[model samples]
Target: MDLYFLGTGAGLPSKRRNVTSIALRLHDERGTFWLIDCGEATQHKILSSPLSLSKLEHIFITHLHGDHIFGLPGLLGSRGFQAGEKPLVIYGPRGLEQFVETTIRLSETHLPYRLWVSVIDGGVIFDDEQMTVTCRQLNHGIPSYGYRFEEKPKRGKLRQTLLQEQGIPAGPIYGKLKEGHDVALDDGRVLRSADYLAPPTPGRVVTILGDTRPCDSAEELAEGADVLVHEATYAASEWERAQNHHHSTATDAARTAANAGVKQLVLTHVSARYDEEGEAKLLADAQAIFPATTLAHDHLIINVPRLPG
Candidate 1:
């Protein structure tokens, strides 16, 4: 899986960065991508990338803030123009449904696809064959949420050599075995998949948070995550302002990443005041606390590698 950062600025857009939007691409795994937050001009940012609106199936909103959702209506409408007719699911706070419905209704827009909007608090919001998603309230000015994307563990490869040596020809039975299901041979021999397959492969975990202060809930939500995407809207020197705004400084984000034992930390939603020089300071400050840190910028892509067997 890979992430494409369509916009990564905080509050508003700047010459150096756009607003907050991210695309989690899973073309190889599921032939689609899940979007996280749709800030202003998010669709425009996607248009500059290789992402396709037709491939976007899910949108996870962190809050109702203008910077986080202003582009949603435009993106939703663009999907129809692109001939996208697949169902789309959106998970967000209470005002999400109303906001989308109001936008579509007022614009008199007709969507050719089904839009499933969920007003979620905190819990497992989505679970499917490949992944399970959970959310927790965050420490923000208003009600905000942090999302945890946990990929489901996959069954190990079937012992093809053993089956071939046993003269068991490969066919639909192999599919059953790969799915961890036992199969009965034509000769009435019961084949146990557990006995033939290796141990289950561990899945990857990714936690993406909205504008928030450094809190224990953030750490809990990111515990052992492979990648923790947190907003570092201020530099360490601006800690007081960050606290007042319920936002995290770069140092704050790094400390949380360290406490969570996350493998990597990607900082986004940066304050527009930070030019390239200030952004360097932000990145360096975070790295000083947690070495595995990177700053996310508009149109930047980060790939999440699979765990080694």
Candidate 2:
């Protein structure tokens, strides 16, 4: 799976970055893309990339802040213009349904496909065959949330050599065996599927948080995550301001990653006050605390490697 950062700037758009938007690409596993946030101009960002609005099947909004959800209506409307026919599921905090309904009603825009909106507090919001998505409350000004995406474990490939050594011929029976089904041969010999299969492969865990302060709940949501994408809206020197605004500083984000034992950290939602040179310092501050820290840039694509068993 891959994470595509459509916008990384905090509060407002800048010359170097847009507001806040992220796309979780799982086309290889689920044949669909999941969007995290649709900041302003998110549709324009997707226009420049290879992502298609038709393939965007799910959208998870961290909060109702304008910087996080201003572009949602436009993106949803654009999907209709683009002839998208698949159903779209949007998950967010309370008042999300009213927001979408009000926006669509005021704009008089009609969707070509079905749309499902869920305003939830915290729990397993989405669970399918390929993945399960859970949410937890965060320490933000409003009712904000952080999402944890856990991919479901997959079956291992069958060892063809081992099966052949057992005098088993490869055919539809192999397919059944790979699916963990026991089959009896014409000779009345029962074969155990597990004997021919290797160990199951563990799935990747990605935790993407919205605007938040340094809190234990945030760390719990990111525990042992393969990639923890946290918002660093302020520099290390602005600790006081960050704390007052309930936003995380660069150091705060790094500390969260360390405490959670996350493998990698991707910092996003940077304040627009920082210029190109200033961004370097913000990144360095986090990396000093956690080595696997990276600043997410607009349109940056981060491919997360699968976890080992």
lDDT per residue as tens, model 2, 1-309 = 999999999998988899999999998998878999999999999999989998888999999999999999999999997756778889999899999999998999999899889887898998988899999999999999999999988888899998888888889999999999998899999889888888889989999999999998899999999999999999999999999998999999999999999999999999999988999999999999999999999889899898557
| Residue 222 alpha-carbon offset, candidate 1, angstroms | 0.7
Q: Please identify model 1 stretches exceeding 4 Å from their true place.
A: 167-172, 185-189
Worst 10 residues of 1 by lDDT: 80-89
User: Each candidate's root-mean-square deviation in Å?
Assistant: 1.5, 1.1
Model 2 worst lDDT window (10 residues): 80-89
How would you encode candidate 1's per-residue C-alpha lDDT over 114-181 as one tens digit per residue? 98999898999999899999999999999999999999887788889999998988899889988888
Give candidate 1's TM-score: 0.96
Per-model tally of clashing residue pairs: 0, 0
Candidate 1 clashes between residue pairs 3 or more apart in a chain or in different chains: none
